[model samples]
Target: MEFVAKEKGFIAHFSYGDLHVSGDDEHGFRPFQLLVSSIAVCSGGVLRKILEKMRMPCSDMKVTAEVERNEEKANRVEKIHLHFVITGEQLDPEKVKKAVELARKNCPMAQSVEGSIVLTESFELVS
Candidate 1:
């Protein structure tokens, strides 16, 4: 991974020709948003795989991450709430709950910020 500085922000170049711009909101993605996205996407992917492995049918999934920042302390992120909406057929609430728990426990991004940030998850199933 490498980053090149532009006039307003930096462009991050990653493997596979992927590029992300990080800077002010007007220019590109903010640094904090990227952090939250990493956690959300990681957990979402894990949850999806877990559900598939358990033979749970899912047609669609969406993950939204909300963050609480402490303005007094350098505007640091204090908490992150991840809401997952899953659409499927005949979904079992108990199974979905278990998969979410497992994903939270196993997500590398969540684990990295475990001590410093409060991470919470909620899910709703649509049939």
Candidate 2:
């Protein structure tokens, strides 16, 4: 990925599109937002695949993330809590929980931040 410096921040150009990154949200996506998003989205993607493989595919899944930051430590990210709401028919709660566990274990983004950022995942099934 290549990033071009702008007056306020940087814009990363990729095959998908351009991503604006900055310290301030007004300029673009904050660095912490991107980092947390990467972890949540990556985990969700892996979970989707795991569900399909387990024959428990969901019609929809939404991941909500809550981040904890330490103000004294340069506002560093301390923990991220991801709650997943899964909508599907005849879904097994136990299986979905297992899939979540597997996703957290396998997601590259989460693994990359392992031992540095604390991650927690929880899921609820809706028919």
Candidate 3:
């Protein structure tokens, strides 16, 4: 991964593609947004795999993240809340909860920021 400084911000070139990041929302994704997205997507992937291994058919899944930032000091992220909406047939709530727990424990991104930031997860199973 490499970043080239632009007039407004920077363009990060990765194996996948280029990402334009800036403090301005109109320009591109903010750095903090990227961090939140990484955590959410990482956990979502793990959760999906866990459900699949358990033979739970997930027709659709969406992971959304809400971040709380500290008002004082540097305004860093204080907490992240992940909400998952999973749609399927005959989805057991208990099993889905277990999968979410396992995902939180196993997600590398979540683990990385565990001590510094508070991470919370909740899920809804839709039939």
| Cα lDDT of model 3 by residue, 48-114, tens digit | 9999998996999999999999879688999999999999988899999999999999999999998
lDDT of 1 by residue, 21-98 (tens): 655788888999989999999999999999998899689999998899999999999999999999998789999999
lDDT comparing candidate 2 with the true structure: 0.94
Q: How do all models score by TM-score?
A: 0.92, 0.97, 0.95
* Residue 15, candidate 2: C-alpha displacement in angstroms: 1.7
Q: Which of 2 and 3 is ahead in TM-score?
A: 2
CA lDDT, every model vs. true structure: 0.91, 0.94, 0.93
Please state every model's RMSD to the true fold in angstroms: 1.4, 0.7, 1.1
Task: Report the lDDT tens digits of candidate 2 across residue range 16-99.
Answer: 888999998999999999999999999999999999999988899999999999999999999999999999888998888888
Q: Which residue pairs come into collision in candidate 3?
A: none
Best lDDT among the predictions, by candidate number: 2
Question: What is the Cα-based TM-score of model 3?
Answer: 0.95
Worst 10 residues of 3 by lDDT: 1-10
Q: What is the lDDT of residue 23 in candidate 2?
A: 96
Q: Comparing candidate 2 with candidate 3, which one achieves the higher lDDT?
A: 2
Supply every candidate's count of residue pairs whose N, Cα or C atoms clash at under 3 angstroms: 0, 0, 0
